[model samples]
Target chain A: MSEPILSIRHMVKRFGGLVAVNDVSLDINPGEVVALLGDNGAGKSTLIKCVSGVHLPDEGEIRFEGRPVSFPKPIDARSAGIETIYQDLALANNLDVPANIFLGREAKNRYLGGLVKTLNDKWMLGQAEQSLAALDIRFPSLTQPIESLSGGQRQAVAIARAIYWKARLMIMDEPTNNLGVPEQQKVLELIRRLRDQGVPVILITHTMPDVFAVADRIIVMHRGRKVTEKRTGETNASELVQYMVGALDDTRTSA
Target chain B: MTDSKAMAGFDEPALSAGKRAILLISRLWAWVFLALMIVFFVVAVGVFSSATFLSVRNSQNILVAIVPVLLLGLGQTFVIIAAGIDLSVGWVMSLASVLSAHAIRAAFNAGVPLFLSVVLGFVAGVGGAALVGLVNGLIIAKLKVPAFIVTLGTSFIVRGMSLLFSENTTVIGLPEGIRDYGNESLFYWVRGEGGGFYILDKPEVSGELLRSMDRILAWPVVITAVVVLVCLFLLKRTQFGRHTYAIGGNMQAALRTGIPVDRHIIKLYMLSASTAGVAGVLSTLRFTAGSAVIGDPLLLSSIAAVIIGGVSLFGGAGSIIGTVIGALIIAVLTTGLVMLNVPAFWQFIVVGAVVIIAVLIDQSRDLILGRRGRGT
Candidate 1:
């Protein structure tokens, strides 16, 4: 089998005395959609944070493409092609569409790049329009501030930004959060598109229907430890619920 | 089936006509108010004949009079836009004026060229204010101190330093060149043949035009215009400007985006202080003296102008152009009242009432917009 795109080995993350992620390991390969399912404080968020470099594991190691790596900051993870779409979407409400899409990494004028470099609005605007159009995302106006956009449009912008950056692995925390039924469907479709385009996605969500709709595999974490991993087609939602509640301890099982 | 439906089409929801109108009014309300006020003064002066408020001379006077306030307000706009305030700007200006005046005087006595002395004085003034701003920024940005308390405390400390340095006396006798630059009109009006004024660059006009009509242009006003232009560019056209809005809108989001929030804030405070320093130099040049209390009244005026300019005290919105107009409104009100023989005390009451009214309007606009769409 080809090497997993991201590999974690016996990772442990603790906040003071409380172990938030205790000796958990996972591997994610290309073109795979992995859904992280658990109740609140089930170590799902903690594990995702550790992978995306928002939190460093207290023990164990993380390897990307078979090489051990450490990310001290979120930027470090981003530079390594791991984009985490945090809850709230982490967007500046005052900025326009193109500005938000190209916030930290703005396109600069090439000729004036060395001297008096300014934002290349023309290029950014064109690219932003094109990206949204390709994703079938329609917004009111690119010049309008993101603050005025509906919740679904805002989520679309965040997803488009991650995809535009060509993230090899995307970590989304509750992508369907606060979304209505239609918006939730749009997000699920976005995730499937990411997977079909050969990008691996790790989605942390509570909705069972969302997991069944798109995710190819489901990993359930209970009390800071991974209890089971199952193929979406092979296992039912009830069986997955048992693992989430710590009712089942099918440890060391490969999907 | 759901995937196909979700992926197939996205219908763009258009903004309703009423919501669009509300947004338009909210954005342009400040400018409209300014224009109406100007019209009111023009009509009042034209009918009452109390003073020549409609003439170019009165306009020049208003421009020059509000230069310092405008400058300070320009700087305060940045601080406020970044969700911070700099209460010490007025005192910082005073300190800069005293320090620069001393430097210029000392250099002139030591046989340095008048121009060099003036430059040295200006640099010293800016440096002093920059130091004060740095302390403010460091405490507010790095140590996480509230900008209000930090700047308020620094204002007192800076005022004390100004007093201590000048030994409780107003520093006088600035270099002749500096004074001339401040007082001299770039363009002046002379008496014309038809009993009106003819604008002339030189005072060498013969016959009836020789006597001064009124200054058409003043150096202080020119400096203020340049400052306004530069600030407009900084706020509207630069990456720093974008970051300022970002930080002000949501600091946590700015941090997650990897913006050096503290550094941007520090730079903002420093810029605010530097503008205050420039205002100080202009003040000294205009008055030919630097007093410890020269900036006392300016504190209230600058804050009032910024708030009145539509720059939300809550931050993340506003423009330098709005601030310029806001400063002009206050200046015009003060001058217009004086021309009408209204007592200075009553002018204060009027301005206070106007500020409260402006804030109420701003708050209501936000509320109305919130009901229409996502409330920023």
Candidate 2:
């Protein structure tokens, strides 16, 4: 790997002494899909939250582009080129596709910036159309609100938002949860597209097929600690499952 | 491109024509209903009452009378769109009116100039109401109290305050200059000697048939129009309006997305109360009196106008123009009934019935459109 985009060392997070993430370390490389595999309460979410700025780690060091960094809030993480697509999608159903995509960071009119500034709807609509088109995602209309869209379309819009914002590192938590079979396939394709475009992705999932399909490497966390890490090319699905349940003692396996 | 097209085909299934029609109709239903009501009134009033039922003077009066209701409705629209309601608007208006009235009286008694006293009175009145709005916003945003309950409780307390200050007596006989300012006509239409009408001309050519033409734009009408236009611009063109809708649509989604939800909501309540204060100032100017009970009747009617205007009680789906039409409908209904010699008691019944019918239509439209329970 030329240089890892993000590196974490000795990360620790706790909730009232629960120790959700204890002494975890990981590295994510450019164009890499890292599948964070773990059972519920295995601290997979806590570790990701720490990186995404949802929770401040009790103790740890996080580096981006080989520089130490801290994200005090979600916005800080977002401004640092990190985007998270939570399981709920965090979309306003009442707002249209373009509006939801530009909810927080809206594009303002060039001449009409600040104090009296108004939204540049035309610019935003065009950008949204282009972004969705880039991802091969089509909606009935850009003006169609998220609530009116199908499940697959909603997911596509969410992913398009992350891509349109030029996210260097994207964290997707259960992106396929509650989606139908075809919708799940679309999300999987989206992840592959991201990787092909040289963007790094952190996918948290319990589904083995998803991990084997897109992940270049798998990191299994158990009981608030990273128990094993493996290269997908070297390990089979059965062996990854054994590591996940702690049946195997190997902490690291090279392809 | 070809691969993307194939994927698009798999992702976006086309909506059937039946579904399209339902969507279109559900969206335009409010406009259609409002248009139909106006048409029905025009025809019925023309046939049953005097031809002057559609006269300009009557229309101007309706416009003037609906100003306060329209202002209240506009503010309520914002609050409701943010998934909240302002039950204290009417009482706030009343309190503001009393405050300004006292300020004006004190100034005049203290030997101040009429013009300066009027200006100072307005400032005091609006400022007092703005303070009340701040309190309301702080309590609701910080305490996390449900808006419906908080505003309801505040309504009674504010009403009592207004009564206590005014001593339950109407302050009448305001300065003639202020009264004139309120009653000033933007312009008027006078009929010619042979019966041809003149536009915005003084009533120089007097005749039995000569009367003020329809569309006599009054000062109050002008003020209402300006206020409405400003609010429309705010709601449609500004980020504040978008944030209001987002917060109303789904507060959790808004908060998670980094929107300052509490602060935005506080500002919305303040806007609602401030508008109410403006209405109070206008009321004092028009009535030339301050009474604690003046705003009582406005409370229910303004809410009714908002509902009739197609602003969903569910929030995040309404417009200022819709509320304007809704206010007009109420004013027209009341005026038409009076012209038809309908009893005051019967007018109340009719207005109440119309409000209930509007809500029923809204519900049926949602059910037929197959979008029930989809607001969030």
The candidate that wins on lDDT is 1
After TM-score superposition, the amount by which residue B249's alpha carbon in candidate 1 deviates from its true location, in angstroms, is: 1.2
Candidate 2 clashes between residue pairs 3 or more apart in a chain or in different chains: B56-B214
List candidate 2 stretches off by more than 4 Å: A110-115, A242-255, B1-5, B8-14, B107-116, B192-215, B345-350, B353-357, B360-376
> Alpha-carbon error at B163 in model 1, in Å?
0.8
* Candidate 1: residue B44 Cα off by (Å): 1.5
Cα displacement (Å) at residue A10, model 1: 0.6
What is the fnat of model 2 with respect to the true interface contacts? 0.42
lDDT per residue (tens digit) for residues B61-126 in model 2: 888889889988988889988888999999999988888888887887788998788788779777
Predicted structure with the largest DockQ when compared to the true one? 1
Docking class of 1: medium
Q: Which ten residues in a row have the lowest lDDT in candidate 2 chain B?
A: B1-10
Q: Provide the lowest-lDDT 10-residue window in model 1 chain B.
A: B367-376
Model 1 chain A: ten consecutive residues of lowest lDDT? A109-118
